[model samples]
Target: MNFDPQTLRYDERGLIPAIAQDAENGDVLMMAWMNADAVARTLQTRRVTYWSRSRQAFWVKGESSGHVQHLVDMRVDCDRDCLLVLVDQTGPACHTNRRSCFYTALRDGAEVEIMAPVADPD
Candidate 1:
């Protein structure tokens, strides 16, 4: 059967958590929120789109940052409440220029930064 964006479960704000992963190496890039429209838009355009809770608007990845996330696949969780977006990521996924937003590691009751930011092209 065909898929429908509306069929997925959403929270009270009509938003679902979406996790972006690198399709090539399986690194989790980031997590963001997506409304139904954002989901549909990402599928239609093959560019990842997210609903910014702070900005309250739709953002097409790499629209300004050049760190584009080209959609490779989109998977729904068994509960239908979460999404996994497999993508071909370009540049650093994190705004801080790291490969992932989850840069800090909590080990032995201590927090440590495991990853360093990538050097800017310019």
Candidate 2:
């Protein structure tokens, strides 16, 4: 059976949550929103694409920062409201230059910085 992006449950805004994970190590990279069109584009191009609510546009990973996410696999949750995108991630996934967006950890009721920002290559 062919998978359909429309089959997935979307919110009122026609958006679904997509989580990016490192294909090699199973590390979760980041989470973003995606519309049906973004899903189709990601599958078609083998590059992860997201819907930027702030920009109200299609955000192709690594388009500007060179931190591209090449799709390895895409999975839908049991509820069909979320997506898991296994990808070969290049460079830091976080906009702050961290390896992941989830850089802060809540430990014992205190927030801790577990990871530091990546230094620019230049």
Q: Against the correct fold, how does model 2 do in TM-score?
A: 0.95
RMSD of every candidate to native, in Å, equals 1.2, 1.3
Q: Residue 53: error of model 2 in Å?
A: 0.3
In model 2, state the lDDT of residue 20. 97
* lDDT, residue 93, model 1: 96
Worst 10 residues of 1 by lDDT: 1-10
Model 2 spans with C-alpha error above 4 angstroms = none
Poorest 10 consecutive residues by lDDT, candidate 2 = 1-10
Error of 1 at 31 (Å): 0.4
Tens-digit lDDT string for candidate 1 (1-122): 25689999999999999999999999999999999999999999999999999999998988999999999999999999999999999999999999999999999999999999998777
TM-score of each: 0.96, 0.95
lDDT of 2 by residue, 7-108 (tens): 999999999999999999998999999999999999999999999999999999999989999999999999999999999999999999999999999999
Model 1 C-alpha RMSD vs. true structure (Å) is 1.2
> Alpha carbon lDDT of residue 18, candidate 2?
99
